[model samples]
Target chain A: MKKIISVLLAAAMAFALAACGGAQSSAPASSAPAASSAAPGQSSSVAAYATSLDDIKVKGELVIGLDDTFAPMGFRDENGDLVGFDIDLATAVCEVLGVKPVFQPIDWDAKELELSTGKIDCIWNGMSITPEREQSMSLSNAYLNNKIIIMTNKGVTIASKDDLANYNLGTQADSSALEVVKGDPIYDSIKDKLTEYKTYDQVIMDMQAGRIDAMIVDEVLGQYKNTQLGNVFEVAPVDFGEDLYAIGLRKSDTELTDAINAAMKTCIDSGTAAEISTKWFGSDIMVK
Target chain B: MNLSYIATLMPALMQGLAQTLKLFALTLIFSLPLGLVFTLGSISRVPPLRWVSRIYIWIFRGTPLMLQLFFIYYGLPFMGLTFDRFPAAVLTFVLNYAAYFAEIYRAGIQSIDRGQHEAAKTLGFTPWQTMRYIIIPQTVSRVIPPVCNETITLVKDTALVTAIGVGELLKAAQGAVNRDVNITAYAVAALIYLAITFVMTMAYERLERYFSRHQKKEG
Candidate 1:
């Protein structure tokens, strides 16, 4: 009886392991579309979007991926509708091309996946175009040059980045700021001192509760929260040096890239981009 | 299939397995005694104690562990009492499995023959001594199989702790998947879990045999 039960137990465990293995190995390949196939007869059809950019029209609507959590850039307003700077800029770019703008809220970590799988035509959130990312996608001229800033509760001052050493610094998981901190030459000096949280709000709450010493976030987002959240937190004077946010298109699709660049140029030349930027940001943020 | 990938992740997954073991060990350490207390309450002559214990055991056992875990992790933050992921996970597992252990204890306690109680009463032995000397010895034997079953279930159920981002084995596997955009790492994680379960099954069989052998010698 014991032998039979043992055999049964072994068999059950094997089956469970196999089932999990199957789920893990099979799902990724099936979820992605073929890398370079163009679809028939849709100006911005799935095929045109997938393969060559030349087959796509400049006038058809292009989908952009944005996360609606990071404030001032792209986030839900008080009415729970997606509203922010990215939305305004995307709307202006669409008007230039005589097409509608479609917004897709993407998971931050899966932003590359969304682009590769043809889920969206571009990533237009506060997406930092890193050199490593340059290998995966064709990128446009940068629109907004920004830097990350560290903020803390009022009356607490950090003199410099060196001063931030040994303090509990928080940033959103999978964020470029986290990558910069984790991969920096100075990371070894303070790597043990850092903590990553799932959301920015959690980091802010920890700062309020005196759990973390400070948090690093996009400068605009830090400024927006200082104005809006009605909290006692204030931004530090020192800023991390500038980085750029660009429009990302699949590497295989240059035609879509050309179309977007042309459309964006029209938006810039006609001052439509600046108008939209001022509406959202209270200043013209169109960069050279 | 991806032996190389599994080899790469083995160290991280081992750390996660350590956490899984800690949760299992600590929950059992606390819940086993709490379960016996619950058993005592359910069998208590005091009507209110009996009713309250019965309701607790019924509710914890009746509901699913997954739902209870979510309630502890997601629901508590709204009430202004937030627990970090690890503590919330351990608390959920302890509360949930303690109820199952309680039922096993109740059944074992009840299996003590009514005659033993009546006999002790006739001999002028106090109720407490009768329970310690007569009921406990007999109940211990019947409780072993159920305890073993609960312990095994608790091992696999540790994976649910990942839903709250506690970074146990399953979430470690998931984090690997998110990075590589491949799922095979999760399958490897399953095999690791199977290995642990296999060792535990062997140990449990050995224990059952040892106890059975001692019983036969006494008989």
Candidate 2:
């Protein structure tokens, strides 16, 4: 026992030495200034970030935060490479900005902190335009339109939003679809049946497992999943409402926000955005 | 069940396993010795050392590990100190596990018969020598089973690193499941975790045997 303890003590000393060298060398110098400097009681600093292309040019990369599980917008492929419309669009935008795009997969719950702490420059996934979001972050021009689509398991009945109350419903919590569903006139009727899961994929799984008879999801994701799943889920005839997808930037990042919007507009005009949109959605769904 | 699908996922899952193993290994390396220091501090005769160690253990063990991860990773930035995500995760885990291990060690050490210490003193064994040569050696054999239990828990607890965006194995499986719209990746991840814990269980068994064999000889 003493021999093993002595050996482990020796190894621990060695590990401590190696960790300081290897770990420090691997982390980027630019990412180290991640402190928010917000006073303890306050949530965030109100000081404007005085950065334009110069700071980004110096850093040489734009770290964009996103929830990588979102499909058709930004999600990993089978090879675990990031794909989907938003990623392609971001890559193109980064080409225009003369900086590399570094996609940082983040916890969706921590997106705002990621931006405020300078961990990521912006949230570039399929973020929906909401009043609360617009108040918190400077939103870019709405690039894509999404609808809250209701999907039910096969061999289920009826039509329209009224019939939705008859079946147990599910959706990802904190989703744009959930926001729309909660505000819908029929939500009062279906409120008892709605089950909010952590992700749309989980909601789809529950629908498949027969735990949930139907799932409310974003149209882009629903269409993508329906195509992929192949005859598993049926989209209800009634669409809940529309949601506009936009880029979310820290409120202080007005210059960066303008840069992204200008780049997006250029992509839409030059047919690049349409090309990527067509590839992902089978049509040009860009908000041109 | 689908061999081809599992094959497609192997590379990503293996990448994630590498990350899990790194965290698990690092936490074990740091926590084991650090835990011993706390155990000693917690059980010491000195008033200040014991109280400080007891307080450290109380704060860490009393709070949820997830909350600690959050405060360290997200909250600490307010005070101008910061750690990158993986480092923050490793720090939280090391600190949290060290507290638990301290308690476990304290229990094992205190359980030893007090007569041994008195005998060591009679033989001119200083306090340090009495602990080093008599008390600690005996506690080692007794502590093995509980330490094994804690070590096994650490294997599964690595999954919680996903909360801090560390991309451990379960998160990797989740990414695959989200992309493919299938549950197969989850099943594969479960098997992988089981395999790790199974190996750990076997190693601990061998360790227990080796110690007990020596323990019997000493007896």
Q: Which one wins on DockQ?
A: 2
In model 1, where do residues sit more than 4 Å from their true spots?
A: A1-59, B1-219
Error of 1 at A114 (Å): 2.2
> TM-score of model 1 relative to the true fold?
0.51
Consecutive 10-residue window with the lowest summed lDDT within model 2 chain A: A34-43
TM-score of each: 0.51, 0.90
RMSD of 2: 8.3
Error in Å for residue A148 of model 2:
1.0
What lDDT tens digits, residue by residue, belong to model 1 across residues B1-219? 676766777766676788889998989998898888888888887755765676677667765776566556544443445576678888888888888888898888888789989999999989889988878877777788889888988988998776544556765565444333345667888888888878888887877776567477888
lDDT of each: 0.69, 0.82
Q: List the residue pairs that clash in candidate 2.
A: none
**Number of the predicted model whose lDDT against the real structure is largest:** 2
Q: How accurate is candidate 1 locally (lDDT)?
A: 0.69
